[model samples]
Target: MAPAGSAACVFCRIVAGEAPAYRVHEDGAVVAFLDQRPLFPGHTLVVPRTHLETLTDLPEESVGPYFTAVRRLTGAVERAMEADGSLVAGNNRVSQSVPHLHTHVVPRRRKDGLRGFFWPRGHYADETEARRIAARIRAQL
Candidate 1:
């Protein structure tokens, strides 16, 4: 169900076809579209079809599927934009200008000059190494 105040939300209007968007993909639960003010070309935002004020507001059952769409779009964006990788991020409340739960999948290339957010990024040496890290998280979960 759409949250209260969705009618005033720009993203909600876009989802409802009341606003314009360069749509990339849409499913029963989510929509992917190009950001009008992209961090880089091919930067896309994946949002739930239902109105949600933030990630914390999204129903727990929808979390996995929402991120699944994000994961799929991340790969597509990278391939379509010829990017080396992608930077996937979401703001809960503080940096969330839209107030709707959305994920940013920004195409990235090495040494693209994006830096200094206090969080340093690194890569796993290979799939095996990455899997090990995943296992650690799974263990905790």
Candidate 2:
């Protein structure tokens, strides 16, 4: 994992594979992976290959490809999970987790029973449990 206090600056190390992650999708410009701590079942994150701190740091041309990936992944998640719809989001203010520019593609369903994810997060109880969850996501990836 990245060193501590990285929450403020950005999480480039995680993106670069300098740190461990259950990486799923990768290409020339973007890397997508399942969220280690997901809000929903098929939650995934898409970030640029370059190390930019925020959305404003991205070039004008970069937005199209990024969103294109997001759009494509939205379909992938929906088809894979058989969901009703999907949630595509970027970190403008409230949804920001890692400072590096990335988009979240969350598959949504009707009876899956989730209100929303605009709230606090609970900590995992132990490493064993976290590992199990990570393993499952890795399989899907």
Candidate 3:
């Protein structure tokens, strides 16, 4: 059966050459394109050809190759935009604008006006609290 929501997924349309995109890179398994609403010029989104919905949905065997593509695109975005650095980020269902999974590689420069993560920062209440949180996550993995 087709992967869930592929019929309506924009990224799947882009992957199938059914939609127009400012494509920067493509391979058998991945596609990279400029974001229409770029945070900064040269911001690109990289996605797997398969319509996996989240990072956890990504097949373990595909993780290395998939991220390798993102890593390469990260460098290219920095060079092309003459940026001092880059932010490579992805969101799960919480902040995800689209249901399709994509990695955002945005060029960054010093004093770019963006502070950390566009949200307030916080610290663990104490070492005990931090350890409890870590242990909870470790149990899942």
TM-score ranking from best candidate downward: 3, 1, 2
Residue 38 accuracy (lDDT) in model 1: 95
- As a TM-score, model 2 comes out at 0.69
Candidate 1 accuracy as TM-score:
0.79
**Residues 56-101, model 2: lDDT tens digits:** 7878898888878888888998898888998887776455676577
Local accuracy of candidate 1 as per-residue lDDT tens digits, 3-76: 64367788888888888999999997798999999989999999998888788788989998898999999999
Pairs that collide, model 3? none
Query: What are the RMSD figures for all models against the true structure?
Result: 6.3, 14.9, 1.7
Best by TM-score: 3
Error of 2 at 71 (Å): 1.1
TM-scores for every candidate against the unseen true structure: 0.79, 0.69, 0.95
Q: Point out the higher-scoring one by lDDT: 2 or 3.
A: 3
lDDT of 3 at 52: 86
